[model samples]
Target: MKIREHLSLLAVLCSMAMVVLDAGMLNVALPTLSNALAVGPADIIWSVSAYQMALLVGLLPSAQLAERFGHRRMFVAGLMIYLAASVLCSVSPNLLALLVGRVFQGLGGAVIMALGIAILRVVLGPDRLGKAIGWNALVVALSSAAAPALAAAILAAGSWQWLFLAKLPIGIVALAASIGFPPSNSTRSSIDGVAIVIHAASAVLILFAFERLNSQPAMATVALVGVAGLARWMIAREKMRQVPLWPVDLLANRPLRTAVYASVACFTAQSAGLVALPLLLQLGLGTSVIDTAIVMMFWPVAVAVTAPIAGRLSERADPSILCSIGGMLLGAGLLIACFSPASAGLSPYVAAAVVSGAGFGLFQVPNNRTMFLSAPPDRAAAAGGMQGSARLSGQTFGTLLVGLLLGYYPTTDAVSLAVGLGGLSALVASMVSFSNLPRFVQRHHA
Candidate 1:
């Protein structure tokens, strides 16, 4: 790659690492935040949930905003908001204050995350984009791997506030880097603001319903109703639009449709493993917080090692087979963990992690390559929005599945349920994988 391309990748890596680290990093700090603010466990959960919701709902709008205004401007502005929010979070005196700060952090995070892949598409050709995405995957895995240790050290040395404080300078550096890189794609006409609002509203309602389904069933019902109503509105609005928020024609396109479905399924299984395994270790099996984090490390470690290899292999053969094989392995790993429950020693859980992680690592890169490249160049930003939204939506759905299982079965049965769901999702994803084989071959020739 050229120096500009290398620099672009570096900037993408740096910004993405900062954002993804925050995903798991906060889980480690939850106990500290709860104690410091004297907040209930329920309220504290919002810290994480709020961030995820903002990212999910704000994604398409961020893409549209980036296009209407400027990618460079939006990126820099997002960094500023992230930095300010981090500072606010560090000094937050009450639960409400912290939650408010987190909302902004999530919004800013949405902007950065949504644009990263879109920006990469502009700088790198299709062949190189896979490597770029591989590196992006590396940053994600590294962040997940590093967040726990980093948060633990901060909590030990200072307090929970330091977690937020630490992210501030890094955000500033990313903002400066945004200045060096010029926007790659030219801007389009004004995006349909009504479509943006309709989608965002529906997403917020759906996610809120999913997240609250276990604790507040009544509220979940209300949220789900809103979700249904808004979804209807979104569909109606899209039918009338010249260009919808989620492109209708793109969804109808055979390759794009299957790829999106695969993205959702693959991520659903991946998210379930990430969320459930740690809970199984710490809450279900009675392990130390640090030890739980240590066990969780295996997943990202495997992903980091495997993604580049997957990227390399994609150059030689069909990505569909790689994806199908990966999905099957993931299902197999989940099944292994389900049947073999973790004892207090953590060995069983570690073994489970290794299997599940390998499956996830195998699936991610090739699948992402297929999704991004499936769309045309002009739609890259929208494709990025779809990619981010699908992953978040899948994670949201995965969390809901786990919650529904826990509601029926006891907490101890959580891992087994997670394993069952993982296996089922993989099976469906594999079917979709078969459909993709010829597409990959055709695209190779094209």
Candidate 2:
């Protein structure tokens, strides 16, 4: 039984790594893809944008479907879809075909992301849940850290097609292993097709607006207006239904809501810092590209090292307290980076990176555990979907914030200011995290 559990966990982690690695790998291969497909840079970007938009839009629907069917069935099906789509992407002769494949791939990725944690919760149960989630966080960190290097290596060895082709074997292995897992016996529920469509359309429009806001203001404004109307309609429709697709009941829980908000703020802060740090290193500090990359490696490495420890600690510690500490550390790290003297050199910057990375790693596992455990077991899939949505939303907002700041200021100091804003965001997240503690204690005592 233990061995079987381990195998299942391995399959889950591999699927997760494949999706994350592909997202990062494509960014590095975009230029190569453009030249090979004889497409403009603008056209090539849709390969990425299409994937992201589809993933964001499909998350909730996928979760609902998982609940209606079964998590294992959905997970295996998603892997199959992703694997097949990768083959399609690899063999595509033109930009349009690749774009189509990417959309399918994104849909598959969405299922995996939305249901992976929920599946983990079921497999590991509450006692070991934190550790499993911590390991999952490590997979994410490692995939992100390895992506650029892996992409460069693949391109160096063969054509860009190899990038997609490489994932085929990994996906196959994961799919095969996952087949041995038992099926979920979740009760099937009726889904509102109209509600699903409205929710998906609203999510897509909102994300699209964020993506286009800096480049095409008019289009973004139109998208924003569409999103608002769609959202209003969805909310109204959901209120009328006993079982809404959006998991409104879960969001109503105070602790869960706080965790979600804190998650968004933390990711927003992390994303903003990630964007600003490279600029500070390369443009402001006069660091070379290679040197900057090497130095920046410190952060993810710290995260990789810290996540497991935090996970173990979470088994005994109050996750809220850990999260609060993490938020403060993250904020402190960013502020330190913000105030680093012009001549302070790489050490200070590296220190800040490690601190912030560790903080994020610590915060993530506990926060995710809170998210998963807070919901009823039956709504695990919904909770997972909400978690993914919150993360993507936070990242999108953070990226947009950085873009706006740089566009408006267009100065060296702008990076510092943006990072400082990120720090403030983390501090706010800390406050939110801390606020959950008293409630948690009261509930425990009761």
Candidate 3:
């Protein structure tokens, strides 16, 4: 890679690594955080949910901001916001303060997450775009692999505050690297601010309803009604706008539709595993925190190993087949996990981690390439927005669904419920995968 390209890639890796690390590390620290802050279990849950909610609300607006200001500018700005939030979190004395910082952290996270890829796509040019994404995914896989071990070490030495503090230097380095870089060519759009608000509101309301529906059904019903009404109004208002935040034409495209569906199903399945597996090890097989960390390492370790392999294979064949295979493998792995005997110990979890991670590794790059390529060059911002929104939306729903299941079922049944959900998601994704069957068969013949 040329010097500029190398720096650009480094900049993205630095920012993304911190984001992924923070996510994994926080999970392990939740117990420590709850006790220190005198928070109820319910409030402690917000430490994660608040960030996701911020990301959910910020997606389209972040895209619009990128389009209006510039991707590089937004990238730097996001790092600063993330840094500030991390500081707030490290020092927070109460549940509400931590939650507030977390929400801000999500806003920062949303800014960089999608735009990082979008910037790489532009800076690297289309020919090398797939490889760039492959490398980016590789970094994510490696950093994610390190997170659990790193978190456990930090917790061992000090308080959970170190989890937030750990990101500070990385964030600072990212900000510095980003600022020193030469700016990419600016692409501006006349953004629809009102539509952005409506879209954000609609997403927040819907997800909130889903989160609340079981505990407070009447309140949830009201929220659902409000969400539906807002959604209807948003669509109507968008029709009147010149450039809606969620463009109608882009979404109505067949390929974009396929990509989004594939994304939602893929992540839904992935999230169920992510949430369930670590807890299963702790709750089911009686693993320690460090042991769970080591076991969970297989997931990102598999992804880091398999991404280049997936990239190589994607060049020789249709990506759809790769996605289908990935979906099937993920499902199969989950099924094996689901049926394993209690005496199976750590083996089932390990198998599931490696297989599902490999599947996700295989599925992500090609699917992302398809989504970015399928959109018009001028509207890459819109394409990136929808793609990010779909992934985030899927992930949010997955977590919410799991929360609901845990609420309704016995605590002892958590793993079983997760397994059931994973199996169902896989079956649905497989049916979707058949859309690529002719290509899969032809590739085999060749």
Choose the strongest candidate by lDDT.
2
Stronger candidate by TM-score (1 vs 3): 1
Per-residue alpha-carbon lDDT of candidate 1 for residues 1-446, written as tens digits (9 for 90 to 100): 67667666676677888887776778878988898999888889989888887788788888777767767677777777877888888889998888888899999888888778777777787877777777888778888888888888888898788888887666666666665566644466677877877777887788777877888999999998888887777777676765467666467667667767987897888777777776767666688987887877887888888888887776666778888888887777766666665453777667767767776777777877777787777666667778788788777777777878878887868666886787779767767876878766787789
**What TM-score would you give candidate 3 relative to the actual structure?**
0.91
Going through the candidates in the order shown, the clash numbers are 0, 0, 0
Model 3 error, position 403 (Å): 2.6
TM-score of 1: 0.92
Scored by lDDT, model 1 comes in at 0.77
Candidate 2 — worst ten consecutive residues by lDDT sum? 179-188
RMSD of each: 2.5, 1.4, 2.9
Alpha carbon lDDT at 1, candidate 3? 70
Q: What is the per-residue lDDT of model 2 for residues 1-446, given as tens digits with 9 covering 90 to 100?
A: 48768778888899999999998899989999999999999899999989988898888888888888889999889899999999999999999899999999999999999998888788778899999989999999998899989999999999999999997878888987885566767565887798888887887788778878878999999999998887777877777766678878888898789899999999999999998988988888999988888877888888899899999999999989999999999998899888998798988889999999999999988998999999999889899999999999888888888888887796578888988999999988889989999977998999
Candidate 3 residue-wise lDDT, 95-126, digit = tens: 98999999999999988786887877777777
The reply for model 3, stretches above 4 Å from the true place, is 179-188, 240-242, 282-292, 343-345, 433-446
Ranking by lDDT: 2, 3, 1
